[model samples]
Target: MLRHLAVRTRFFDDYLLHAAADGGCHQVVVPAAGLDTRAFRLNWPPNVACYEIDAPEMMAFRERVLAGQAAEPAVARRVPLAADLRGEWTKALLGAGFDPAERSAWLVEGPLIHLEAAESTRLLGEIGDLAAPGSRLALAHGLDPGEAAGPDSEPGSGPGSEPDGDPAGAPRPPGSAPEEDPAAWLTHHGWRATRHDRAAAATSYGRPPGYLTPRLSYLTAERRPPAVAPAVQGRS
Candidate 1:
């Protein structure tokens, strides 16, 4: 099971990184980054800056691990922003030299499930506001079959505690409303989203369908500003 998840995660990360580079983004943001090694492992161009946003404790832990291994990032600049995502993290990101006017890549990988739906939406809105035109977003929002039917069958109950899922003992936020299809959600909010199922992605990676169990919904969207109308020529 762990192997399956690792494969799926690798595939997702590779795809997002390539997509971002292809779209000419110079900055990349990974929210709630916990033990993520992409900054050090991926083959990034010297101009790309990767920011890992997480709590102070998490950053400290990651630093310790890297120090022990003497691991250095491959990217030109790797910034670690120690701030709570539920609070004023965006301020810290900006203070750390994030430029809202420049195109960037945003990755919301494993942490969205831990936030309430409204909080997740707000986070998305914040990203949208910070993103310049042609920026890219990659998200992994997996839905359970039970989530589609209706509200949770029991009060105060939530998704099962998968042992391999999320950080151990990480605080689970309050339960949220059922999630809308991410593609439609992104489309409604000024993005052109393309959704991909895990099976198809696994096959593309030359892996069997069984490689991506408990299928996660993966989507990549590009910010599309509304087009301006052409001026009338009759007066001229």
Candidate 2:
């Protein structure tokens, strides 16, 4: 699990940096931001704005830690909004100065697998609605090894049992049905997505593939331009 966490962390770090530096996105949003410190650790581009959203308690804890450490954000602007993802957080985000019209990068890591399918879908839909054309998204999810290996295989362990460790012994949520392909779901929502497995991630990070588990996958997608209606010719 430590290996998986290390690879996943590196993958997202590189992903966000690439999104900011090369993908032409100046706005960064992290939903369920938890105790993440990317705003203080990463070197962002000039004029970039980062918004981190999480539960009120989590936000307070983060602020207290940062304050104790006297940590400063590496970006020009870092806004921390206290809100719940399961609620109307979008309003809070916009109120905190997020610009929906601007191209943005969203990192939805470590939390989706904990949510129910309906909740996850709703969260993704909200993100799609807020994202403008050419926006980028990166997310991670855990897979059911038994499902991946086929029905004949033994029942696999759940995501909460993984080495990464769940917070406060929260019960593991149901696995998303295999038919609900994340890439296809994104495509339907007007985003072009690419899925990556553990092997790919380990290879990219110069790590051995021995730690590769069928338990996790990553996705990176770009929001496509909205479809335009065809114009009708008037009778001459």
Top model by TM-score, which number? 2
- What candidate 1 gets wrong by more than 4 Å, as runs, is 144-178, 213-215, 227-236
What overall lDDT goes with each candidate model? 0.72, 0.78
Residue 10 of model 1 has an lDDT of 70
Query: What TM-score fits each model?
Result: 0.79, 0.84
TM-score of 2: 0.84
Residues 20-120 of candidate 1 have per-residue lDDT tens digits of: 57878889999999988889888886688999999999999999999999999988999998998889999999999999998899888877778888888
In the order shown, the candidates' Cα RMSDs to the true structure are: 9.2, 8.2
